[model samples]
Target: MIRKGSQILMEVLQEEGVETIFGYPGGVVIDIYDQLAKTDIRHILVRHEQGAVHAADGYARASGKVGVCLVTSGPGATNTVTGIASAYMDSIPLVVITGQVPTHLIGNDAFQEVDIVGITRPCTKHNYLVSSTAELARTVKEAFYLARSGRPGPVLVDIPKDVSNSEAEYRQLKDVKLKSYNPTYQPNIKQLRKVVELIRSAERPVVFAGGGVILSQASQELTEFARKTQIPVTTSLMGLGAFPGSDPLWLGMLGMHGTYRANMSIGACDLLVSIGVRFDDRVTGKTDVFAAQAKIVHIDIDPTSIRKNIPVAIPVVGDCKISLSQLNRLIDEIDLTDVPRKRQDWLGQIERWKGTNPLAYKQCDLIKPQFVVEKLYELTRGEAIITTEVGQNQMWAAQYYHFDRPGHFITSGGLGCMGFGLPAAIGAQVACPDKLVVDIAGDASIQMNIQEMATAVENCLPVKIVILNNNYLGMVRQWQELFYDKRYACTYMNHSPNFVKLAEAYGAVGLKATKPQEVESVLAEGLSLPQPVIMEFEVDKEENVYPMVPAGAPITEMLLA
Candidate 1:
């Protein structure tokens, strides 16, 4: 039977178990939208193309599935760039479909025409421009496969307007065998042995897990390995939920705003077993000096990420879950009953670091952002699926929230995209309706995509927005305060609409808390509402996130406030 390209795409999406899609229609995508309406898949029409991609990103992060988005050509396709790039950096799996101008107009610079496939080539794991209907199903299959396989990332498929209406004999290809796309899932036995030997022998050992663990759904294995080995674990920003934040052995997030203990532990460790992490510049302050005293064993599915940032003594190339499983099996073989656990001293030192200068902020008449997050965590009992806008709000959320489950904490780590939380919360809430989803946002960052409130309101998603209203761009202001001698340029945002009225105008609830005492009550009321809400907390204007490791400085060399 012949099928239209749009119909074939829908069939493939159904086969892929896609339950929902976030998209915005345009001139080139009218047929696709028509087909979309005929399918069982729920279509979320976002206010902007960027929100659609971001919503898909959040859904992917929250559900551990390949989130999908669709948009039209030219401006619609271009708007998705940042969202796609954000997903790429964090290694989130996404299949982004963009509408393109009909084939004959390809290089003619037609209306609503731009080379999106070429535009997103660098950011996407892979991309294709399908001018013919024959390749539609196969290309989509390939796009989804490439997106969720190995080191997960975004993939784009540009479908010309003409192709959507064209006829094709659709075929269901389950075994998508791409000759050049083989990913290593198993690690070398010798290298795995070396990693185990180091772990067994080292007295001072630390586990640094990254987003790879979460992407592979290996958090249970990660937790088991850490506990069995009696090693403390610290996660990158993207790896927040990879291990239980409430676990006694779990150190807070490790990076520029990492806990003092985590940074110091990494600095002093003899065996740094880095798992599923790319040693990005933010995590490894100075390349030469990062983990200088440690014998680093880097395990990852992508070989490029292994030595891309820092040199490692052992590089085990394979999937994180598979490699860790192998290491765990071998660890079970070793008779460690004779060798006593020698990590007590190291644990004690980390505890000392934790005791000396912990993540703390003073409570005053003005609302404190840290206090707000802490209260939110307390009220939610660490069960809420929390997302964040970039800046001080992101850092504070990371520091305070205790994520005990994988897929419960979603945030933009690598791209540090502002206006991420609100739309992301929409996606997360849509994915897990029964769960509480909140976006911990700063006053400045929240405004970046404040328009998303309409999406939430229209959908009646009930996603909570906890805005840390400090009347300034908190993070950039912090940098200027410390590094540029308080040359606060355009960071201050003094004049703003009353968020409560703004929420009401959008057909949602809005509440504000000016004092520390009113924060909890305001939060509880907002969170309990049956509709979307924007709760603005008037936090201290000059308060800055501390235990900050300035750029280029050693992670351990932190400036504590």
Candidate 2:
């Protein structure tokens, strides 16, 4: 008796130590789903295929594991596009499996079929369209390897329906080889020496760390490097948890809506050593003006990412962890002693600015944004893994929530996608069942994937959802308030379903806290429940996340609303 391709896929997954998969089943992928059911691998059925992918992304970000998402072809596969792009922009590792039409109907446009491999090629780190049962094992192995290796991003495997049911030898693919896909992780010592030379000579050297630090598991290395070099550090949104938020040298996220002092630090630096961060448009407003005075040393795992946006003085293409280790080894301990702490005045200025206009909110009768964030921080105490929906809530969480360790915060930083939180929370909870996981979302963004509460309830995953019930697309409304004269068009969500009631209907705990006085109690009650809970807070409708980085403004020119 020969094994089915679907069985082979599961066997490969087991070999890879995959514990869970997030997915939505469809007709074409039923064989694979059936195989999944027989295996010990826990499968989470998401409300939308898109949510499944995003949840997988969250799992990868939180656990540092290769996330797996499965969906059927055509619309089912296509639905995951946004989530795939989000993972791509943030460089998260994901392995996506999509069911295809029968192998025979390759280009005939068969029913319930789309060119998924082609559609996902640009967004995915790599893609495979398994046309024959013979190629199934190899494809699956290659997909996993590609997803988990170097500067990881989403990888796609499109398996045809007939191929899934086809008979083939059950030999596990052990000797998988990809000549073109090998990831070089060693740092160039010569280039690194030049970097050290630059570091020693520069008066003001700032390290602009990005998600790459976490992805490369180089957070400790980064902290050590900063401490040794006596350089102030600033981070991108995705890089928030890579360094201790409370560290004296660490300036918070740098971007539009980034901390004022952090942005100023980025602007004032003479030599900017950016690691594992792609200089996105949001972070580097006008390329010409961003870090204009800084000589950039761009270090990253992906070579293509070097100098794509910002000019680099030294481009070191290697794994950040490996590179930092090499840098640590090469630099003599005594030489670092002479590396002067040249930025005391600079540090003092930044601290003074941070002290004067710290992230603050009024203690009015209404529930404030900071209070909601602070309460969550207090309850969870930097232990719970957090996924944030885009917009003001995301910024607020980034600003107020002190991330004590790396990989504790997951958000759609690169794409800044709105409907990311709930699904991501599901993924985080699945990745680390012991940890408290929270999805902090806006009421407008929460409704986007609120249906995933069913997934949480079904899996018995206790994810606390704190909906900042602002009743509007808070981020866009802020844009309108500042730029468009407050002429809100489609930001209001008066037609949204009652979120607390919606949570109840999904067979999970439901809660509401309309005032600051009720915040602590409702949060306590929500946290006490071992099942999924949705706590809705009626925040000030017109509230805004301060320290706004106006569109296209230089990092130093932030606006406080």
Candidate 2 lDDT score at position 554: 82
Kindly list the per-residue Cα lDDT of model 2 for residues 243-351, writing each as its tens digit: 8887888777788877877777778778999999999888898788899988999999888889899889999989999888787776654366555556676667778
Residue lDDT tens for model 1, 13-86: 99999999999999999999999999899988899988998999999988888999999999999999999999
Model 1 Cα displacement at 49 (Å)? Answer: 0.6
Q: List runs of model 1 lying over 4 Å from the truth.
A: 338-340
Candidate 1: TM-score? 0.99
Where is model 1 poorest over a 10-residue stretch in terms of lDDT? Answer: 335-344
> What lDDT does model 1 reach?
0.92
Predicted structure 2: lDDT: 0.87
- Whole-model lDDT values for every prediction: 0.92, 0.87
